[model samples]
Target chain A: MTKRKMFLRMITASLLRRRSRMLIALLSIAVGATILSGLVTIYIDVPRQMGAQFRSYGANMIILPGEEGSLTGAVLEEAMQVIPSENIVGATPYRYVRLDMPSRQQSFTTAGTDFDEVRKTSPYFSVEGEYPQNRREIMVGKEVAETIGVRLGSSIELSYKPLASFEGEASADWVPGAALLGSSEGFNEAVLNVSAVLDEEGKISEIEVDALSQTENIGSLVGTDKAFLDQFLGKSLPLTLGEDVDALSGATISSQAVVDALNSSRSRENARLSENKEHYTVAGILSTGGEEEAYIYMSLEDLTRLTQEEIMDVAELSVSASAEELEGYAANIQEEYPALTARLVKRLAKSEASVLSKLQALVFLVTAVVLALTLICVSTTMMAVVSERRREIGLRKALGASDGSIRHEFLGEGMFLGGLGGLLGGLLGFAFAQMVSVHVFGSSITFQPLLLPITIIVSMAISAVSCQLPIKKAVAIDPAIVLKGE
Target chain B: MALLELKNISKIYGDLKALDNVSIRVEKGEWVAIMGPSGSGKSTMMNIIGCMDKPTMGEVLLSGVDISKETARSLTDIRRDKIGLIFQQFHMVTYLTAVENVMVSQYYHSMPDEEEALEALGRVGLRDRARHLPSQLSGGEQQRVCVARALINHPELILADEPTGNLDETNENIVLGLFRQLHNEGTTLIVVTHDPEVAEAAQRTIVLEHGRVAREVINENFGK
Candidate 1:
């Protein structure tokens, strides 16, 4: 230990004696180590942090209900009892029903759910209007609102049609199981002319509805009182309701996908006719930039009342969890809810994995390049030291310093610088990672305990490797020539 | 038996025969001064004797060991245990203080001891300036520190080339007085210089001209 200490002292003295040059090399190593440690930390952590971010895209584990169109019993409650609430951000029940738009003579997708929990589950949805609180309103998504010729507070009619419409006399009304040779004649498109909007009072209001889509032909009808609004409050707004023929002028009325010139998928097959009709006003507009953008949402109570069945249309329940543990969570859910199948949102998980892998690769590449540059800088500086201390080395050699002793001094110096550089770099790298994470990802990361040892090892390895040629040069000095001042 | 011996040693630098057919021997505790002008192969012969360079053709024996065929590592051991060297330039690691510079030799020789280094500095009469860096010291003082460093290893052979060549009259007297004191204590020393006064202080003086020994004189009043 004394010998070691003496060697350390010698190296320390040597370093102090050559501060400027050694400082430059130390700074280079520190910079390199900082980049290495910081990027590695980010590479490992970015996936977890970004995965949490993508969780806002919604569920990683989606548990489908027993049957395709319905859940059995108070099955959602059973599912809740089975799943640990700590892991659950949202466990909402949903019901899907066909919405018949009499104004547009078509059916659309209307979803029924508790909107409050949905806010937590899919927080990335950018809502333009407020969410509905009661059974008397509907939340129309952006694509639906654009496809449908409706905006906030516009009255629409939806008819329930779970099955096919049969051949019958084409009347103003369409009902299921009737031989309705459905023709576009005697169809009385409901014309709601709002006299006044009653704010929680049995009053009158005037509402002028302008059909935004060319397929829609809305006419005005004078309406007043609570009964009028209530009767027209729970209807489904089909995606094709507001088609303004004047806007389309010489064009055909179709869906949002067909409203463009480049849409090749828009055909006559995408249309639907409803057997029964109910009315509701558009209460909200939601924009999510996802599949949820095309949905019409309502409360389950209103949907049940309209369908005249205790309708539990919850076909699936999506649970928010991390990607790594999601599969295990899914398996646990399956063991508990034997009738239900719990599976991961594989596409989302896969894409997130792909992104994380790419980022890790990029960090590795940058780290490698930085390390190479560090080796070159350190090696060059050490070589300069060798050149400067030629006389000193030669003197020591003549004074009976063995090759091992000379090597020991330089090796100690290299390791000391490496260790010091690593320590400084590790701390600075963590700080930099925090800054980047907070600035770019808008979130903070946790500290990794493993980074310390990793940086030290890498720094030491670099230093030792860089010292090889310089040490050889130092030990190879000829005392005779240098003592002669040659 | 001689403490140091060279049998027909020849040192060649490419085409220049720096030392040709030179053979010399010195008994234990002998104080010898090797006198030669520049390029007379004085430095070359010293280098071979000091184990800094191998003789191109000859046998060298130190303390009865034929080390002429020794490898560099073994030569290093011989140099550490039996030989010490000094130069006119006072080649100190300029950054280290006097004490640390002396300790450096001790460090390579064995374990470095701070007290021993201070004692060595005291021997050179630079005890008070032990903490001074080489640059802070006067030229003669730096040379004294180099002397301290060379003696710190306790070698049997101290080979000093131009020990007082760069010193002033008073500094040279002071340095030569230390050498005379060490020689009286029976330390073997080979002082290489062209100064007749420096050679006169030795028990024997060997003169070289053009790489061969020209003359050898025995000094009867070396101490007086």
Candidate 2:
């Protein structure tokens, strides 16, 4: 017989000679290995599943202005340093301006945004019509567009009320007679041509007003507007001058100036609107279903004019990598930059945290207990075997077998048993893991290719170590007395 | 030439002295028997001479090499190669068949061959029963297998302890005849026994009293 075959035959025969006792040991080993394989599989998959589950919440990380910070674009860029540029998927800045809508005959809030950044950062915004491209083109929310009867190519006036300047912290009830820079009537106004109308969840600049008088025809409204203009201008003048006399009453001029200033700003932005259609394109439109439909979608320049700020308010950042290396990317960003955090969410995050953590902990604890019990079971079995075979060991030694050879024989038996058990256990463990994964997390578990060799090696090592004392005792048996029965 | 020697050998087991200052010599091709009363140290001397045990004092020499200083490994080498052992109880591995039992000795040798084992069994006239296990064989047949095992390695010294002590007359005669055949083949043999009849069957007989050699006698018709 070949050497390996002979050795294997010897091991099999030896094991067979004591099959009843060894079966218990074998069973224990198998159980231990199964638990080990299953738990390890879950451990490696934890972070990936959790990250993805968290990502489904729509926003992974939000960029709020740092404490004691400005919403200016430059300040936003500085805050970007604290964030890992690689982990950010998108960044958008926002600025709001309060203005009057004559068509609505009421005050409304308005928001100016970089449409490209908004589209990249907000997955929730749903647009119904074509997105706005030119400065003259504005997409209004469904609610405001309907009230103004403004279709595509319709011109609308926008007025902005400047923030009241105060030297120190002021209570909400405190009111300045007139804004230090200018009264509302002295502020800027702009006119925008409607390009598209959005569905809902739109944004609008905030403005205060009495009402807009609707004229049946656009031609008749512009034609008879001189007497109306005289009255409008006459009422708007005294309100700014009389604001110091009474801050809360008869200040229609300051209020009307806010409306005019908003319109003027909108018209000026329209002049600068160049539909390059390349660097500047319609990213998306938000449909707030209110004045956002009357509000306009534009570039950073349009947003600055509407908000009366030098730069955009909100900033968005993002990074991309191969699907396989996404986890590494996340880890690298988190490790390299602790100030910023990246999160992957929704279903992946929720399952990973809520389901996987509990499951893994359970598996780990169970595996540890099973492994310890397996070691004890195998060790006891082997000790009994060594004692029973004391005479056999003596005989072999008397026959010129070295102590090393004797030890090798026993260790070989342990290794063989361990490997056989591990193979069987690994198969069972993989099935068990899959079942638990599907039942608990609603996903099929994949068998890892790496566990095969690792299981066998670990099982063999554990068995060998457990068998150490018994094998040594067997090797050191006194042959002379054993042979003579002394 | 002397193949075995003992000088002032003694063996003590706790409070009992199994052998005390015993000395004996056996020449090559000699068939010798050691006779003693119970506890007279004959068995103890046999154990020492066969290298199974060492004397508490004194030395055992095989072919003039002192064996008292030999390590356990070296002593085992002596048992496997230089000295062949046969027991009265047959001492055959019961799991193996007749031929396999004979081949057990060849395991100690570096080059164990099936052909050599078969030839040795054939010499002992047990080739036909080669496939029969020890349990299947009669007492005499099992002893013959043991003889074949001992001769297969062609050891320089053959130590048989009570080779026929547990056998009937027929089996005893069969085993004694085999020893004669081996002695004719130029192998030195030492047989330890308590019976005078068994001692008389050997060419020379040494008697032990207490732990020392008492007397030596020559048998005129050992083989006859």
Whose TM-score is greatest here? 1
* Quality of model 1 by C-alpha lDDT: 0.72
lDDT of 1 by residue, B1-224 (tens): 99999999888889999988988999999999999888899988888888877898999999888888888888888888888788888899877889988888888888888888999899989999999989899989998898888888778989998888889988899889888878888899999888999999999998888889988999988878
Tens-place lDDT per residue, model 2, B180-217, is: 88888898999988878888989999999888789899
Task: Supply fnat for every model shown.
Answer: 0.58, 0.19
lDDT of each: 0.72, 0.62
Query: Residues A226-277, candidate 2, lDDT per residue (tens digit)?
Result: 4332222313222232232222223233334433332232222122322111
**All candidates: interface RMSD:** 2.0, 3.3
Error of 2 at A124 (Å): 16
Worst 10 residues of 1 chain A by lDDT: A259-268
Q: Which stretches in model 1 have alpha-carbon errors above 4 Å?
A: A66-92, A101-106, A143-148, A155-281, A288-294, A308-324
Could you give candidate 1's per-residue lDDT for residues A168-234 as a string of tens digits? 2222222222121111211122111111122233221222222221122321111112232243232
Chain A TM-score for model 2, please?
0.49
